[model samples]
Target: MTQNQTHDPSGLSQEQAKVELLQLQAQLIAADQAYHQDDTPILSDADYDAAKRRYQALVTAFPRLQEIATQLDTVGAPVGSGFGKIQHVVPMLSLGNAFDDGDVADFDRSIRSYLGLDANQPLAYTAEPKIDGLSLSLRYEKGVLIQAATRGDGATGENVTANARTIADIPQQLQGAPEVLEVRGEVYMSHEDFAALNARYMERGGKTFANPRNAAAGSLRQLDAEITRERPLRFFAYSWGDLSAPLGNTQSEAIERLHELGFQTNPLTQSCASVAEMIAHYRHIEAQRATLGYDIDGVVYKVDALALQARLGFRSTTPRWAIAHKFPAELAWTHLEAIDIQVGRTGALSPVARLTPVTVGGVVVSNATLHNEDYIRGRDNKGEEIRDGKDIRVGDWVQIYRAGDVIPKVADVDLTKRTGEDVPFDFPETCPECGSPAVREEGDAVRRCTGGIICPAQAIEKLKHFVSRKAFDIEGLGAKQLEMFYGDPDLPIRTPVDIYTLEERDAGQLAKLKNRSGWGDQSAANLFAAITEKRNIALGRMIFALGIRHVGEVAAKDLALHFGSWDELAKALDLARPAALAHRSADMAEDQERAEANREGRRAKIKETREAVLSRLELHLAAREAWEDLVGIDGIGATVGLSLSDALANAQERAVFDDLVGHLNISAPAAPTQESPVAGLTVVFTGKLEKMTRDEAKARAEALGAKVSGSVSKKTDILVAGPGAGSKEKKAQDLGIRILDEDGWLAEIAPK
Candidate 1:
């Protein structure tokens, strides 16, 4: 195993391993959904790989937990709902990753051992750049294009035939193609084209993608083929999925055949006779990566002989004959000019390092995220020393890297290169934008501005977030437009309520929007129409658009589903406020007690004061029940529940919510479309689920319209218990909930 694949030295018990495994599984699944389905990735490729490696290592260490490691066998995200689904004739399996030379050597050895060949025996392998773009499979029948689909969850994919036809590189007809051929390739955007597209999008006041891969994927997956055609997308056919007949005897020959058939194959592909040659070719590719004009994350290698590949066969989610050797993150050294604090929509005072312009991974980065004050202090959350405890200071030399080819991050500081004049960075104790007290709460890494809507930066960022794609997604009101309108005195949109009343307010104003610089009569009218269209919004979208801290899209959806409507949700949150406050006070009291442990008098006095506060702000039965219900929802937990309740409890914030809802007709959460035996039932799974992974079970239940909860409650209609079921099973029994074994539960939710 490589360094990145190293497992923890301290052994974990079976229960501990299972807990960690489940957590990892959830995180990985979320990452996959974000990247494949949502076109937004939260974790960097390196971090994601590292996490997967750890998860795999844990499973290997505890073979008993292997049955629950189903996510490891999954190839991609589920097919998106936007397009028609197509089942692939041949599953588009993912390749196992090799991070270093030792891994490559091991891969070669494994193949040789499997083939019963000596180490000195010759083994030809074909190597090519692993393009970091959207995977597409083009099906051709009798030398004519038939269908095109994206690689969704390996077996099934989204049909994008119309969009595929728009790409100039994808040929409409192939003269020498077989009767049935499924050509697999990558749809990519060149660096120049990606830059141009982003520039155009910015000019038009639209949101731009993070990278070329995202740009290409988002472009190709457009509902409108005209949009896809407008995007400069290119394709390079490198592999074949379903073929009526064999293309060639060797992988290299097959690729050459693809090129001959009028499909663009990567020209740099080479056939290597040995592992050493393969490594040499990989190095050559890495050297030319920046100049390639397109993004390639790694190099893929496959057994040359078709017969040998067939003999090698496959793993659960990857072909045994092939492996992708991934590239390490690119790093560059630059001078740290200064550190600046930027307030986010959540009022997080994020420290960013302004650097002397330096190119890293082919992109010139002038700024990098410092993460937080802890990062600058060279200490982790546990106060453990990192980077040799070298605190970052202005004028110090810094090593920067683009993690996953997306976010620029400061990796390390060069203490030796730091000038004597350099001083330690002092993070601000007040909001720079509004001069309000910026306080760091207990256990929170970031210091947040308490200015709320009074903070100009936070207000503008929140407005931008409110109109973001995942939020209201107003067509004419993008980040640029919102910023412009926020600064304009005549057409100021300071809050979510302001957005709805803009048209009415504008009608009475002398400075009409139609007379503005970028606004024509039609455009102005269209903006109003778009805003009006969103007047009747979904409960989940409205909650997310409110920009409440810790309450993201997923949390908002959970809340919406639980409460069903705005009225119920608002009432519940309002009642939950007192209990949530009491909980916070108790936690603070505990902290105070811990701090004053040596001084009994002070501790007693503090405890008394806390008791008095709690008693005076006594929560009624309804309030206590409300708080329980809010926290009881699956995935809400105490933290999110507190945030939600607090947001509604604050007088100033409550006014905003009230004003916003007053203008809009907010709809209740939509009911599940499909009716099944488990529909409308709250199901909880506990102990070891032998039949399927926890994630799989949750997804299955949700698909069948069952509400899957983490904890067993009075609301739980059924509890599925497996081997070693403990507290949850006892709780279910106490609550008089229906219980079922794994097989029994499976039978209950079976097709009939």
Candidate 2:
């Protein structure tokens, strides 16, 4: 703890210390992202802690790095944009780590000292294997699994309910559970299953994960739950986050009750009366780790009594009464041979590190992701210089780690070992597969191919997305089946429209599909029937299935509600294109003129702006209104608006969309609850719903022909007031909005 003998890694100067602090903060943040966000870790825990210590020492040594200290207050970075964020009722906390018996003793001693207990006093603990997998919090209400969230940061998480539902280990309904219960657990992939998955990916020339943990995390976070369903993911319930009522008197009793309530509880979890017993259990679990057929990085010891845990309380980022006794980190040194770019189905150009084969953590790793171009260019994702500003180059000696049995990632590059021949890997400006322009948009971390359907990868991915769980969801038409059919010269399922015509065409050159390999008469007929069943699909589903860039399920819903029908949505897209183009052209020209004028110190009016405006007179009222309406939607910003408009305007994209729409009947948006008196009325809900969640209330109102809006405006006809309703309730009263309690609102929608 003493810094009197501290040697300055940044040299002995305040300015150098400032630079060092920034580098440390950048390094720590990047490590958190690699470990938590990407499910891949480059640094060992000890090395990360050492860097933190050095950073803290520098900050203490210099008075100028206070801002860096402020940033340290935020434990992890913000949640990624790929999923919907959920604010936890009770913050999900991480556990402090203990690497040896000395740390364990200190942890036990600290707990006893906090409680003012004597040396001989027994401190009971529950010790269990810390599963090396994705942490999930499953909320159950009225015996039904309502929602599932991933532990993104300590305070917030990403919703993964759709993906969670696909796991067989997860219970859909609990018979003996409380009215409200949140069961926390780890979702993992068995070693056998992980191997099988990698084998399949290898066979298909698809992505093979670095380890089981990455595979589990990637599979669970998939946008399509069907992708998750096919992956062998399992859950082990070990803890609880939020609950309305108490399950038992103690932590051990609570876990037991969970077992009795049709939930899976860790069998190895046991109560240890003394620190010696806890250590013995920890050792036992450590010995069994390899034979468990799954990954476990550590053993966790927590206060067995719920009351004691509460009394002990928590730190900023971790619990005080629990500590994770982590095993030593696995690491190895390898040679970076090359950096290869691979295009994904979404056209994302991912950079992969081709490394000389190295044995790490009991596996030979030859490949790892460079993450993005920024990472390879000696900078973190935030543009902060990393690796001491030494960019990764070919023939570099790189240190790699297989943290938590997950992805092997480059930790550091040995610049001393680098030769003059070693050079920076240039990320491609064009797609290698399709030779299309690969563009990285402003504010985007990824570079994507712009070839659209002309790119084989994009077309296949789009087709897969079309039949995803939230889209068409044809029962027998899965990703594997689609992949097989798409590549076959005999079959015609290259596009969404082609899928509709499968039954009408011959199965193969050999014979009909029923007579071919892997296909029977019943199976072929079932595929046809399933496809037919989804002919009449929801409008929102149809929009989502189109796979328009920047359009997700929520966006699709917003568009559907705004348009009300497929015809209107199509017409809006069609009309909005030219208007958006004209606006963009004008905006760009004005920007260019201003820049040029600023540089030359002279003012000049752009003649092109007027020309674009004159050219767009043919836009008509529909085109103008379409562009306005698209941008006016609550969540649809100008960027997404432009993307949608451009997608609709593209010749190939429009052709594919047109063909798909021709074979389908998109059901009209359900009319506002005509039976209820509040039908077609704008409704605002405030505070917490006791009988149901906010999402459920909104859905119920929307189903009854009510338009649910977040704020209480002049347009709001009804306001559902729940307990703790504050600003919105006052606004409703000010606007003379009809406000009703939870019971009163339910009564209105109730049958007479």
Candidate 3:
């Protein structure tokens, strides 16, 4: 179950495979949190993708494991706390990745199989460059730009409407657009612009970004609209989300439609008739990648026909109809000069390698992630040998690899070139920042500092995350400014509450903020105004701002929606605290029992422990009810539930939470729309859909306010049955539910 352990399910027992699956899930979650939430990736894209492939392979080998492997169903990290949340009507899912031609062929074969098409069938696909930048969704109402959001956790996104309006490539008005259209695309910066921007930053003594993708993302997420406007950012429309009406009958036609509507569509987008053609187009795009000016990690191939795409539908996190054929990772050899342990917001001790500058894929790589102590020691989580058991050390020549704009990572160590003086790195057992003990918990890959708020590094990182674009984004208070303020004795803003009382506190200070370095009266006033503006914030934003472990924007929003108010949420958490604790104890006991059973070849003990835990849990009816209420909300699982309850249960944390909430007005979450004919109704689709794909039907129904279910239950209001309708259809009939044919279903959802 170690982070780097990759085992064939065939070589392991079912219990062992299950344990490994769980470990992979945890690792992937951490990876997603780092890459998407913190904008700091612990693993390279190539490594992360490989881990996912390994995870999928295990699930495929042990089919029953799929039931518990829920992490694969998620996309992106939770939305950060700062910006307004935009619920994506149609979730912006990710694409499956194909690292090689064989994978690409497999992708095509899978699509064909799902659609019941043979290899000789002339199924067409459109291949376009997958831009290595931030994903954006532009919502247009009445052919005019209404809002813009970043892909935050797929289900919901951060509102960047003002910043988006500043980009010239994004059209403010689309003449031929539908009444409601969500144009999805990439917000990117060209190589020239990125270089120029970095040069400008260097001239101004500001920190320069590492690559165009990072530059584009940082620019787009700016708190100040003017800052975003100043950045040379561009957008390319390639897809649609939440469309009121169809853009076109096919994928290529839809891109043309987007182009006609004044958005910049990729000129290299081409429709191919076969897998060979798709591969050829991928190669063509790969060849033109460097000359494209913008960053593109791969070429995306999507089913050309819109109807077929609908039929292909989507996996939990990725689309079934599309795949990204990733370009091979570029590698270069460099000397490892030093190893540095950096403490993150969550107290994780992350090891980074200082490398001799070398060019990889045209970008100079000076540093790479070591991942953890185990990776440094050339061992996987299971103590298995990796990198031929060649441990990395200072002065060692290491092979570093970079894929697209992903952060560089050490691939292997060249021990043959190692100097006599080179020695294995001695990872610290104490927090280098605060001298606190750094502990690595059981089953954890990385050690963490127990310094809590006392650790300056952890404190500063948490503060930065608090004021970050996704969190309580106060203009004029960026990471750089916050770091400066954190160390300032006169104006120390170490906590969230301090940010709120700054203006009042500054009024009485000997030297006011306006008189300080890099500040003026207007700028200080603007900062105050920004802080005040966020005083009255959304419930989800407030929850996310608390920085509770495992409580990201999405989880916060789900809790907000279920509780409707802070008081209710607090009360529920209080009641569920004991139950959550009990459940955690039970889970730990079950894990121990399972492990013991696996070792002793006894399964009875595991079942007995589970049943005992279940019985004990039932004894506390009120607590169990409250816990169920919290976890019953979709996406709120045991991990998040435990974290939420524990955060509230802790006296110190509760004091901090209370102090912070006292300064803000938290609004209730927005309720779902209920005006449509099928609003509030549960719907199920069965059999082989003809007029449209089952996914398309479900999307349409949900858009019209219906809850789409995979199964026909007693609560099912309607069943849309197709030609091959079987068990679900029969169940609906047995339940006496209303049944509609494909045509009838379409008619039922048609505009009044």
- The CA lDDT of each predicted structure is 0.78, 0.73, 0.77
Which residue pairs come into collision in candidate 1?
Answer: none
TM-score result, candidate 3: 0.67
Query: What lDDT score goes with residue 56 in model 2?
Result: 48
User: 373-491 in candidate 2: lDDT tens per residue?
Assistant: 77788775457776677788888999876543224567688888977887788889898878999998654567889887778878877787788655787876866687788777777
Per-residue lDDT value at 493 in model 1: 88
Question: Residue-wise lDDT of candidate 3 within 64-97, one digit each (tens)?
Answer: 5553454444555566666889999999877666
TM-score ranking, best first: 1, 3, 2
Query: Over 4 Å off in model 1, which ranges?
Result: 1-129, 132-143, 146-171, 174-184, 187-235, 238-295, 299-325, 508-516, 593-619
Best-to-worst lDDT order: 1, 3, 2
Better candidate number, 2 or 3, judged by TM-score: 3
